[model samples]
Target chain A: MLHRIEPRSGVAFTLKRGQRLKVSDPEGEQVADLLAFNADDVDEVISSGRTLDYASRIFLTTGDPLYSNRSNVMLRLEEDRVGRHDFLLTPCSADTFRIIYGDEHPHRGCFGNLAAALAPFGIGPDRIPIAFNVFMNVTVDGATGELKVEPPRSRAGDYTVFAAEMDLIIGLTACSALQSNNYAFKPIHYEILD
Target chain B: MLHRIEPRSGVAFTLKRGQRLKVSDPEGEQVADLLAFNADDVDEVISSGRTLDYASRIFLTTGDPLYSNRSNVMLRLEEDRVGRHDFLLTPCSADTFRIIYGDEHPHRGCFGNLAAALAPFGIGPDRIPIAFNVFMNVTVDGATGELKVEPPRSRAGDYTVFAAEMDLIIGLTACSALQSNNYAFKPIHYEILD
Candidate 1:
């Protein structure tokens, strides 16, 4: 069945029995599709030496074959409560790490986190893909053509689940605490129900 | 006077006054330029409201034209501690926001921050620019050609400072939260020095 999160928000497509979702973030834009997987699939992937971790409300899933370089399924939603937030693009690079944390330690940065997520598979900084900031609401300046960032319309606890149609690697960071606005230094929780 | 930050592991350059510093990602895909400016010039841009704020680490001086987008400068390095960090590139989107403060409210994402920063100028999501993840150390997998994230080798207080040779609006965030991984959330500070 297909579900909608808000009256005018993004749309969500649920997988039915015997249906499979093919997802991909082609162009590294950070967008994904949907699918339904059981614990066995999750265990099988992990047993193959993959890792999935979470922080605060964000979940980072990493593995092989769920997605490919040229064209691959980035993520598949298994379940979703906040459909709009489910496909929200990953946060942009600059804004992700510093906003959460203060400027106490400028030396320590997110480059490492990004590297760790991709390095295991032999991916390097040059090949890092452009991610989609799914579910996040952004606006642009009409006259000046400037981009603006803002809090999403969705609230906390809202989520979407998907099954991997291909092997994929996703990374999540709670975000540091340095922003003058928005949440700072609060712990968010997430779970992977295979 | 000009300065240079030698790469601890790779090539480094020594910069002289009026000499420009151009830095690219490790793989040499993306690049950014940096020029030295006096405190007076930096302050003029700030006083003119061309740039938003300044950090103490940066210095502004006269005789330098704060370039703008089309006709205005997007960013101005009003201060600097050259050699501490190279003006290689801008921060990542998520890290940019985290440096601003999304960690406290783990549930709240960086989108709001992006909005807040852009709202003043009437910019919106549609206008949000495709930002570059500067100075981040990402690795590409040799086998699968996948990108990975990693912690930066930059030390505490190591910063990448530069003037907006062109008027370009920028969004920044500090990433790297344990909530995302095992990396502890660290604070990042910003100063608008004149």
Candidate 2:
């Protein structure tokens, strides 16, 4: 059975070691923010620095291992249809809106959504780290080190497969930031595979 | 009074709002990892994403405001003798040494130093986020998005002044990673200014 994550919403669940997760962009240009924490030790959460440092690259894809703070492999990217992803960015939140868009009343973005979804698992907002932004297009100007967020290049039905290297608590979101999805919202489709 | 953070060590203290803290490299080619949290609420901590987003640039210098995750200004770079700083990478840890350097018995890097120094304030290892790396030089290849850590250009006496925008618990470290400090660990000097 496939599970659907509503637009701007999120979900959290445990994935046993060796399990695979297929996250799909049913609607083209949608973004998903993914977080992983070791189920046995929540303190050992994913570390973007460790992953990027080991890979020596910012763009990660198939065969890349996602590492935890304790130098343990938590997940591996087994397959990918969209190659552009962002690990340098934090999930958008109410603060993102208020600060960037100047919105007085803002909707809870992916950060808040993840906080709510993962709260039942005993994870608090403070524990959340920089997420692996799936299908999110971000570019850095090398000359000046400026960052730009652009619409994703993922086509409809494009997906990525992640193989759990350890028992993991996974939190995934259909990103809510307008710029991340080109100003439109769409649901995310995901399925667990043996 | 001047405070000295010994090589490969760290210190944590409070900076009242409107006060300024000057961090200096007493010896050349050193790196300092700095972390800030709202003194009132530890959950509201420094955010690299918010700061980079608001500034639209990764190389922060004088006049750039360091933001909290809540989108509030925590500190502003009032003066910078070394213009290049890194908000992109994370503080090195035992995991970094083990994973990157393949060290069997790795020394606890900045992450562990900060954890020990900040423990008195009730902050845990899990709560630590990516720190603002002072005097650390990192370059990215635009074509490949690969990262390269280079020796810092800051000479002896190079310093930066951060004016607190809010009451903050500040953690500062004389980086322990050999690569970050060009293989020589040196002391970091700091002073509070009215």
Candidate 3:
């Protein structure tokens, strides 16, 4: 078993087949965005469209097979607790701050974090894709189909586990959408174990 | 082919099996949120969680099936052009007004329009679910796991077509997310075909 723990800041790593990754919110109420890619061919990556097409779902949970663009099975939901990871909404990027909050927005966004994390791995923006928004409280109104980007519904120690189906290039970002009503982008507990 | 075009406003209809519904951004860059219910049991309606769980996807596109909470297939994506509808983001609502944008943001939202439209059908707030956010520009940066919510990538008159798998009660709302960087909430084009 291989185990590595990365803090809430943006982080990236590779996991061999059968190795698993566990992401947790120690203080709770924090959301994290996660992305994964095929170590061999970055072009063959996770696709929300194709995954939803094959699984027929909009939100993700335990025991689900995460699919790639060509319908390749990339990972499996080995364990989950917060049950409500947002695979739907996009993460806030630096450009997102400029576009939504303006150019002077002080906080750094998930884009820069993920980009820098992957830069050492020789990955670039063109190879990037949206992430699996973990622990984010995004719910739809049962009355009018309105969607809300609320805070995570989890308590301290809530976590989810993912198993790599193949060699995987992983990008992880602690979400920094401060206006999302959280005190701050809390630290994320990331561990990869064999 | 039963064809009816509803202007950019909330509209409700009962689609029988084999019927098809087309939602369009006639002038372009408009988003339409859609919600569906089982004509037999409204309780077993659209579940964003289950839909994404089953599909292993976050975005909707051509040939994808919309599933209910009970995992029943509701609608199938027959065709799509501006393939960016948000099933992840919640539609703006009345209570949501004071929550996110505070009490000051003007412009009517999808909730009011959808509620009024479904009022005649006796579908109340408890029955509504997060809509399929159509043509809403939501993309993620794969390398850094950054998400972006910009305007639609469609040109004028691009559209998506959905086929009803079962008898469905659909409530359509032209998004009036006034904060979504437009002159105002632009009107959308809704047409139901045979």
Q: Choose the strongest candidate by TM-score.
A: 2
- Model 1, position A98, has a per-residue lDDT of 36
Q: Which ten residues in a row have the lowest lDDT in candidate 3 chain A?
A: A1-10
Off by over 4 Å in 2: none
> Over the stretch B40-75, how does candidate 3's per-residue lDDT look in tens digits?
766657756456534545666888888775556899
- True lDDT of residue A44, candidate 2: 86
Candidate 1: tens digits of C-alpha lDDT, residues A105-143: 442222334445445544443332223333333332222
Name the regions of candidate 3 deviating beyond 4 angstroms.
A1-8, A142-145, A179-181, B1-194
Provide the interface RMSD of candidate 2 in angstroms, 1 decimal place: 1.7
Predicted complex 3: CAPRI docking category: incorrect
Best by DockQ: 2
> In lDDT terms, how accurate is model 1?
0.29
Question: What TM-score, to 2 decimal places, does chain A of model 3 have?
Answer: 0.89
**lDDT by residue for model 1 (B102-167), tens:** 454342222334445445544443222222223334332322323334444444444544444432
lDDT of 2 by residue, B1-194 (tens): 99999999999999999999999999989999999999999989998867887776778999999988777899999999999888877789888888789999998899999999999999988778889999999888766788888999899999999999999999999999998889998999999999
Candidate 3 backbone overlaps, count: 32
What docking class should model 2 receive? medium
Candidate 3 on A19-91: residue-level lDDT in tens?
Answer: 9988888777887778888888766666554454334345678998886644468889899987776665445
TM match of model 2 to true structure: 0.96
DockQ each: 0.02, 0.62, 0.03
DockQ of 2: 0.62
